[model samples]
Target: MPLYRSWQTSHAHIAIWEITETEDFFAASLGFGSDKKHPKRRLEHLSGRFLLQYLVPGFPFDKIQISPLGKPQLADQSLHFSISHSYPYAAVIVSRQQEVGIDIQVYQDKILRLQSKFLSAAEQLICANDMQRITLTWCAKEALFKYYGLGAVDFKEDMPMGSLQRTTPEDALIDMRLEKTRETCQLSGLIQEKFALSYI
Candidate 1:
């Protein structure tokens, strides 16, 4: 049970798992199939479901449906939830009372190359070319996008990353915006040894 971390927000249950199980283990226990082309992706899909059930006991898996916006949701929106995975890490946020979003990303240098695609010039300056900062910023916006649960959002323009404040070495908060709905809020983030996690 490599349940890396699990916590609760005011309205949601959140968890991040360091995938240490064999693919067969999850595949058999989950009994869920995946069409992901990569082996790691298949493992991630199964493990994500595992965490969803872990966080929300008796979660209605059968009611899951893809919205026109491409969000995986329930027909009645009974429980708003979101999921994200980064290789050996899988994260999920589930709340019966409100919508939720969560994202996890491993520290990777590739974020530098793609920063221009998702970060405004000002956001780039905020990141200051630091790898972890850049990765966390990207991760924050991703969480915002999932929170929106709508299609066709511009990462750099529609969802922007704002100032970051770290209260402790392992905990942080990011000021973020969702332009489509003109939303401004603080997104919670976690700084870990190998990955960054964010949610809203």
Candidate 2:
């Protein structure tokens, strides 16, 4: 299957790509030099530069710099964005107005080990039997944190999956409470054998 998928939300534009390796995409698309070959560093470099290019065509090199908060910013400040990746995919969301975030995770046993770090007690009870549900919950909260532009927020202590109402594969509601601020967002996705790729 192709590695890219995208949709426009009421507040922002979202894009997701399934990459076999992050280095291949960054090196080819962003013109990274030989010295910047490490995957994590390359991704950080490319993601900021790419988003700047998206906001301003032919933006000058010296004008691109990430903020102290780690948010990408062009000297022009035309738009805002966030990016994330897991084992096989990288995702980005761009917005002209509201902040946005996107994340993708491949289902793995390691998620079980990390559950307490990301899930609340009530969330665990709600998703105990359904592995896909648990993964989706984790991804949603991570995306939400990224959307908030706060890195390293504890998913269990800082964010909780609130009431959820499932309507259909393409139309479901996910409510969340983060740091006394409440947000209700819609989640849409198709389920593969063991993974669910969610979008909002």
Candidate 3:
């Protein structure tokens, strides 16, 4: 199976799929009807849909709609789900209990150059290593953005990092806050060999 990892709780579940199959495989397996000009994007979309069904058996994959903010939602709001992809992997988080978000990013050195765009000066000082810190912050903000399910969010100004603790070489726990909504939550992260995964 392509499922790289999965986490389950009483209210929510997260599944990550490693997209090693060809685009034709997904198109045929999931009945992907929409034609995406880019092969990678098409694979991501279909893989996300496939992971969604795996999480919720018999989910109406064809009835999903996009919100004004670009969030994909079920037509009847029967369930809430979020999908994210970064190159070779696609992640899906589903919940029948509450809102959810998930993000997976392949680690790259370029994130250091783009740190200021999404992280504040104060937040930048919290991490010991530039690459790992930046990747975690980016993943955290991305997950937060999905949880908010709204666009027009300023990553540096709106989402702030409260606390960052590295428990192991491949795992970290983060406390994040949204300034506009006054909401706060903890996000768990896994620093894999090739990519980093964060979800809440």
Give each model a TM-score: 0.95, 0.73, 0.94
Candidate 1 local lDDT, 88-112, one digit each (tens): 9999999889877888999988888
Q: Which scores higher on lDDT, 2 or 3? A: 3
- Which residue pairs overlap in candidate 2's backbone? none
lDDT of candidate 1 at residue 172, scale 0 to 100: 89
Predict model 3's lDDT versus the native: 0.85
Highest-lDDT candidate? 1
Off by over 4 Å in 3: none
Ranking by TM-score: 1, 3, 2
Could you give candidate 3's per-residue lDDT for residues 74-167 as a string of tens digits?
8887898989999899998899888888888998888888888888888888865467767877898899899888788899999999988889
Candidate 3 backbone collisions, by pair: none
Question: Per-prediction RMSD in angstroms?
Answer: 1.3, 3.9, 1.4
